[model samples]
Target: MAKKRNQVRRCVKKYIPYELHPDDFLQTMTKIFCYSRWFGVAGSGNLVWKIFGILILLLLAIIEGVAIWRVIKALAGWAVDIIGHRSVTARLAGTMFYASSIVTLILSWKLSSSWDELAAFWASVDQTMAINVPPDKNLKNRMISVTFIIMACVILEHTMCMMSQIGFDCPASLILKRYTLMSHGFLLLRTDYSIWFAIPLLFLSKVATILWNYQDTLIVTVSMGLTSRYYRLNNFVAKFSVAVKKDLSRNKQSNSLNSRNEYTWRKIREAYVKQAMLVRRVDAWLGGLILLSSLVNFYFICLQLFLGITQGLSGSFIKRLYYLVSLVWLCVRVSCVVLAAADINVQSKRALRYLYACDAHCYNIEVERLQNQLSKEYIALTGMGFFSLNRSILLKVRKDMAGAVITYELVLIQFDDNGTTAHIPSQSNATF
Candidate 1:
């Protein structure tokens, strides 16, 4: 089984996109979107010259579109590698990750098609039964419409991009390196990677849970979504290790006793500070998104609980059960991510243990200074830097979960006593 796994891994590796020049795509976007391409005449020319420039720019835009397709194809290959289908579970996971998204887009589409029926139902239902209805009956329709429209645009554009990259024959490292360059080494505050990498993961996790099912789909999707966060952290650590090793080697070669080289030691010290700051920047980049997911998950868990209670209080026995099961499953799904995220934080801090345990004989003045800079002893992954994601969060969540359940139970009891459980009257009359 191990041999087979390795064989599959090898085969998969053989197919990854090679020789990625992501800058080309960036440049293409710049050209297409930049207004300078259409106006701002440099060389003296007649009115015909302006028209000629416009025509030429349009031609280039068409040509760049073709190249953009290739970039997309290359990216598709990269995404495939990231999905990592070397085992049965992995294959199923990749399939479900994508299939679920497709299914959600479809479900939204189907709901959109039945808008007329929904409209009629809303019209027939009086304001008394409209407890959940928006002030505008069309609000739900608009939300679904807008959501799917955006989804369609993204999906279409990405599809073209992916199709263009299929068998694109680009080197993955080159693509990433160029992406790093284009992104100014991730310091430019650009959001290309976040859009291309993070957004899809976010969308996938949400969509997978869109239409609840009693199966492993939720587990698979949450895991896949968190993979991006894990990958980013792992990538940073790898890069950080390489950086530290290089710094250590340089420190070891330096003469600590030489007063003349004191400035060099200062520069090395500065580099250590920069690296530490960069680690925080890495956190800032994706930390908010992960935190957002955590918050959303927590919100929904409470929501599911409240929904279960309210439905039960209102005599929706089956709905209450449905939500009860949903609440449990949602908690389970969230626990998986919280625990995984907590583990990530723990491992991230543990990366420093090796340095702490390193032989002190190898230390120089600069190295010692660098060590002091990192002397906090541990740095864990955080959610928006607001709080650390560790076993502590799990405990806090447990506490909060109990509070939320209690709060909802109290509210449900109050509503039941007040006879507000039937908050909305059922609509049986038809006027629409």
Candidate 2:
């Protein structure tokens, strides 16, 4: 725990603020809206204050406009037509998500631009504006160059994954199933609910799956050389029995350690460590977003449960049906958050397990060094130091939700008017 504290303190460009205060609510909520928060911008420095001042607002508007344009194109099927692929709708959804992220980023930027501007905006607008959420200033200011890189990555990652399966002659049905999900999922997101609620639930679900699956992709690249060798030799592959067996069998003949000499073996080992380090760095950068999303998901779980017990029992048929649909969607989104958190932790654990193996040849000095480095913190999705995301955190969330629901239920009893409790004004969730 001290090491984790030190690890956080040492980060110079920390994107998450550790303080808890009035803005913490807005700080937590703002992260959901950031798409490229983790990536650094080029030319963020080197600008003359005058030139930057003149062009910054123009640049922001341009970026926000383009983001909206891309999203509209995607939602309207223009992207689908251009790409000519339906199987990777998640990719499309991701692309749109990143686009909205830009708009959100700008909103946050404007919100925190200066205290004066915020006060003026607030005065001009009504009190109910959702855009009034605050920004996390701990993020470094260089964000201009990051947008293109993220855009390319989203396009290529999903595209290449599908392409590789086709190249390998995997069954078309398997590919179609993954691709068709996004198209339908978006339609499901369009379900009749407050557009606000639908936005986070839908995007959070898709992004969570994308990031979660990415750990598998990361593990596979290293497992071919690093994890696979020892997982089998040390008999540490039981966490995921069937998938481990299948992957072990498929890669059974590809032992780089056996085929390559000590020099090449060291190279492979270094590559694996580098990949693991790279993954940790990315997680560190995205940790704020993950933390806020996880926290928000916790709130959603409580709200969903409360609505189920209250709305499901007393509301009209349409309201009940809406509750059922919203419940299912929220379940999917929360599941993705937990799965992403758990899988990343598990992948690191899988690598760490090899440290305890009996086979000396299956490990080495570099492996030991890597183990020590990982042991200090291991790989975790941390939220601005509020909490570390993992499987167990989900349990903690549910426990908290149970407690909050009981309290809310008791409160609703006081607010109840006559027999129907429907007259309660929907308090805009500050946490949302």
Candidate 3:
């Protein structure tokens, strides 16, 4: 029986690969053999590298946390200066957005470096496939595959967030959006790598969960939106500054009876009304898109949790709770959009105040032109479904002041200061 077994083994060896060097084959076998023995007996030197790698990852996570905190602090300061007294919840939401983004950034770094490490390791392995080191053979090989997979997923997600930030809507934006969305889908496939990279340290890490949740991508989108708001606000403040300057200069030109302030105010009011009307229309479309994306995200999280629980993972309880939390956030997002639409009424009130304040004789031409533009704008906003839904706004603005109901209504839409006149939510409101 021994002679027959030896003959079969020899036949298998001869057919395997003649190109493999005898020295390489021996080295590979020796390493595998040593790993099996070392794994059975603890405290082997081969385990030291694995311990070191884990420590490196943990340290990277800590650094990431600090960076995120700094960003949140900076954003908070900006928000305070801009809005001048936001609610507690707004601050907390900003913190979460910064926090989640920082976490994603750290994970991206780790995954990217890990991929590089794996490539080096893989090259070494292929060079010595037939001849491996005995002490850390299997230990090193296992990490190569794991790290490579993790790295690929993270890079894809980061790319998605970048594309979304560039104003993706339709045609040009739609093409990019599809690509960004595909990256998200790929990240979902590579989720197992994210899980492995995050969970071992027991920090309730959601690097993988958030990628699958598309939270990172959404945060990036919100960041872009916030940035857009910042620019608009800066422009408004600039225009406001210019208007103030013109008003100061006009006080000295009282004899002309038609100084620049009158002209500037009239022009500003007309421009403001036209832009606000456009904003009302865009708001409806933006609101719908956000709500739909939120729902999809909720569905994705729930499905992921269900799959995890069904597969008997240890964290099913936490996963389910997480899904519920995300669901609540989505509901809140929908509510914010609805409230924003309602807030248009308040915005129009502010516009009217500006219109009523203007000088009647010197600003008559500008005022008439602004009123005409407002009429056209009203048609635009009402046509977009936003104005129609909030039909009571005109009546309410008219009820508030009798002297110049139409005029006030026209101007107020663009001059409110409660963070909604711009029609874009402050970064404070959009985070997370």
Q: Please give the CA lDDT of all the candidate structures.
A: 0.37, 0.39, 0.35
List RMSD in Å for every model shown. Answer: 26.6, 21.2, 32.1
Please give each candidate's TM-score. Answer: 0.35, 0.40, 0.28
Candidate whose TM-score is highest: 2
- Candidate 1 accuracy as lDDT: 0.37
lDDT string for model 1 (1-432, tens) is 676545544433322224321222123212222322123121223466456544543433432343244234333453222111121222222233333323333333233333344334323322212111112233234333433443453344333323222223547644533332221211112233454543333332233333222112222222222332333333433443454456456675533323222333344345334333433543543454455456545644554454445444332344333333445545665565566555544544443454454445433475456556555544455667788766788888878787886775675444233312110000000000
Query: Clashing residue pairs in candidate 2, if any?
Result: 41-142, 41-143, 87-179, 88-179
Error (Å) of candidate 2 at residue 260 is 7.1
Clashes of each: 8, 4, 10
Model 3 residue 293 lDDT score: 37
- How would the candidate models be sorted by lDDT, starting from the highest? 2, 1, 3
